[model samples]
Target: MKKSIVIFGSTGNLTYKKLLPAIDNLIRQKRLKKDDRVYLLARHDISLKQYIEDAKKQVKEMLDWTVLEEVLEFVYFHLNQIEDYQKLNHRLKDSGYTDNVFYLALPPKLFPEVAKGISASGLVTKGDASKRIVFEKPFGENLESARTINRELWRYFDESQIYRIDHYLGKEMIQNILVVRFANRIFGQTWNHNTIRNIVIIAKETEGVMSRGNYYDKIGALKDMLQSHLLQMAALIGMTRPKTFQSEDIKDAKVKVLNDLKLDSSSVVFGQYNGYLDENKIADDSQTETFIFAKAHFMNDKWRGTPIYFITGKKLDEKRSEIIINFKDDTNLNQIFSNAKPNNTKLVFKVAPEDGVKFQLNVKQPGLSDEIISGHLDYCHTCNWVGNTTEAYEKLLFDVLNNNKTLFTRWDEIEVMWEIISEIQHMNIPLHVYDDFDHLKEIILTEKGVDIDAL
Candidate 1:
């Protein structure tokens, strides 16, 4: 079936940098039909040629202009104007396109208006699975607001027709988490509180909130990163194996983990980077936290007493996203080898900068000595193959096109995630100041008495 993709906020960074490149890659792969149309909708009018030129300047990759130009169209849209949506509907219907995808790249505030406009204009058939809408993260300011957004969306579209995208779920390594745990007997058997000492999920960025101070300040690292990406990652790591790998079953397992999550208020640490107040568009007295480190435990029997640490920050360290699972040291090893100390075995799922998996194992010394040392078994997913791997947005867009909801978040997941965030917000955790990752680590150690480095 031919599809028409209408992109709201077509002039934004996401559309230019990620969505456009993703669409171009999909075209190159022939995943999108030749008859398919991409309608770039913005508040102001811009020629298709100019839009492509601007996108080319922003997108670093060489786009397939020859193919892209054939399917691209531009539409002027006003979110508050019902007449514009009517025209859009007519344009889409006139072109014999009914399998529509409305990508709401606009801010969360405009989601309701767009939903209402689309519904009132009859652009989408309610309860129709063929027509879908996509929404980005920071879904709402809090739990109530998230519910409100969901209610407004449900007023027009069915839950099946809504795609609450968490692009992290589309990452190669993130998707690999399920296969690594469920497909492998070694990890599957021991993935519990008994064998695991601690699980730490870290996402650090060296750059500050450049150009995003306005957005970042409104919702700090906790809401922006922890509530969506980090929590979703934790759920993937902690959830019980799904009955089937289908979308609904996977979401059911993830929601179970989210329900079991209990945040440790005493262990929570929030910090703002030095000179954050001087950032562009930032208020002088902004108390927003650019960094957050919190420990949470699962209430379920499988993961009870196991501490899962969530850490994320901007302008702290090198850009990295990884999950580190530290296994409990075997006391029997010390008794067997009198000269050997217990080695803390760990498994790391490297998510960014490079996509790979690493396992820390205890190995005998090369010499005839009985000494044991730690060695790493590393597998790099992106080392030699630069262009082979699919980008997250490309995979997500493909899934949306094929009606695969496995990678997109469900509304239940969003609700539980917001509930967790609401709990943290009520904690009234004081915002501290820090220089970088090391400084933040020191503060955590001194204040919370938790050595994150060792974890």
Candidate 2:
């Protein structure tokens, strides 16, 4: 997160729905200083009063009245008109600003322009206390576009100054995979090829595009989710120890996670959902894929040959997200009490609709019978229990204020992400057909206790 936040595309859906609200919540929790300035940078041509009222209404709807005053005070907007940007500059100077963060929350096409313009303004000095940039998803349409965004960011800022916001990594449980693994000696010792078998990271949403049909077509599931969000989760699950707690160090390990991936057609599966091509808003001839599932590998000593399965889609089944790790096959597999096993265990980190971690372990049934079974040692995070469980947006904004980059993404991560996903798209691997996707969809729906046909 960049300090003294300047958010581009502040008038967009993400800012109104996620960013500003999170900031308001954090302020209510007293997690931020009153002095931190959050400047909205958009071409909306709105007044300070107009933006303030819009943001205030957003805060009111997203939070209680307790959060409104401080939130409204800190949030100021820059219209980004030539004169407005200049006028905003004077306002910053008179206000005695120390740090600045430029958040590019717009579409991919606007990235280079915004970066170039911001740099030309001379506001992004390398010697500042903390100058960062926050950008949303679809960093690029593909490998070339990904490189383009990286190049643009490079022109204006160094690797450290760019904080790519992959909101998935900011989720509490997703972040805790490392914590659960490394903190507990028992789990950490067993987290390797010797014990773990298959790891599946699936981000599924039931509705197709909702209203972003055209945008969805341009960048399908492969680019939208797997390239950034799902892969980030895979990196967290498979990475070895890092040297430091810094974003650079952690991202250094993530790059290896990508380099280790099997970047070819074989030993992988890629699928696309096209059921909506003939539906209400989408084009009848469009080949836009709403669903994607792929198998990947890390050719490293620890996780060599371990299958990393990834699935993401917009309109599929229910709206659910999770990471499941399955251990290797067992011999003398008991059929009577099939759920039970000697060494098999599973750990699931739930990221959305709620935040929590649940693990599966085998044990004898709580009866006189000599049968074993599987059960969960569950830690579920219910929002009802919280005074301050910051949303991903709030946490990112706070990181910007505090100049913390640990929770944000780095460029190398983006590069590696594009390289891996682009391989699958370019090669046109022997993909699983519609039926296979439906089968997987059924499996996913089974998890939610819903029959696919019923919907």
Candidate 3:
């Protein structure tokens, strides 16, 4: 039987920009059975038809033109009071279908409240098929907040029913981390145990936080990106071989890394930007951070001594996101070392702005000279290759509809991700303000705990 999906935060970016378009595509491809029902929950009062019209228009504007729907027949929109228990129960029961999924695309603050309200209204128990809720990044400010949010969500749904959305897992490149490591014979052979020198995962954004000043302040680079995106990438790269590729096995390995993380790292560093403060409409006293750099060490037998460098920030030079794997360079004994050329084979996973992977090896530069040189051969992700691969929202929404919890993070992972980040945040490493041009040099010159230069 087709499940009924009710998307919370229907007017939010996830819904308008991603989920609605995905559903439109799914419907166009006949993936969403005619029997399925999609409902949009928002605070504003709008008719079902109006909501569909708005969605179709937004899809056309923000995304591809092919996604525009002439008429959205399956979607319904309604104003949500949330506190009105009886009204919510009655309205949901009106669906006459039990296979239900509730997607919470709203802000993190609203996650627990929405869940509790739904529970109070008995919408969770009323579902005959399944009861699930999905949410996005920064599950909480810290471990304490994460636990609290979990508690709030549990009141409405069990751990099994809650789906915490981590887009990093859904990214083509982030997921490829596993495929590249395990599938390739050459890399896998030397992936660990004295063959690798270091792993640097950098997430750089060209633009500053446009309108999310308040949101960005409370959750800076560490909690916003590192605790979620970068760490997930690191976990995949640093984890011991899993027994299987099963979702449980994959997640189990990820959870172990976070749990086993060491807090006492003189290697870690954090930072905040200065110029962007003028962009924020909020007060000057706002302590929201925009830049963060830190090194996490895994003292395991295989990965021991291999540095895991993490760099992420806003209002930066380039809009590139990648993982640079610097292999052990031992050409110093040769003339190549005298030429100041390092044999660093970087396995770059380009995440945003472009999604693809390329291995930069020391290949023959070609042409006249026999001198060794380096270049890259990229395996570009053509537009058509993923023409139908659903957006993050669509995949997640489908998971919610199918009652799948594989993509969701376990509370244990949440607690641990926060545990590691909380210690770094508590230390309050001195911040170094810098301009975009000389930022790199400035960081390199800073003292330990006080230096951005260490990066």
lDDT of candidate 1 over 1-455, digit per residue (tens): 79878899988988888998899888888898789999999877789888888777777778888889899998877889999999999988888998889999988888999999999999887898888999988798999999999998898999999999899999999999999998999987899989998899999999999977888889999998999999999999999989999999999999998998988878899999999999999999999999999999989899878899999999977999999999887768777866654536899999998899999988888988877878889999888775768999999999998888999999999999988878789878888888878998898999999987778
Candidate 3 lDDT over residue span 272-302, tens digit each: 5666668766567666667777777776677
Give all TM-scores, in the order shown.
0.97, 0.85, 0.87
**lDDT top scorer:** 1
Off by over 4 Å in 2: 1-3, 33-35, 48-60, 64-83, 263-275, 278-284, 329-344, 382-386, 428-455
The TM-score-based order of candidates, best leading, equals: 1, 3, 2
Worst 10 residues of 3 by lDDT: 70-79
Query: Which model, 1 or 2, shows the larger TM-score?
Result: 1
The TM-score, computed over Cα atoms with residue i paired to residue i, of candidate 2 is 0.85
Among the numbered candidates, top TM-score falls to: 1
Q: What is the descending lDDT order?
A: 1, 3, 2
lDDT of prediction 2:
0.70
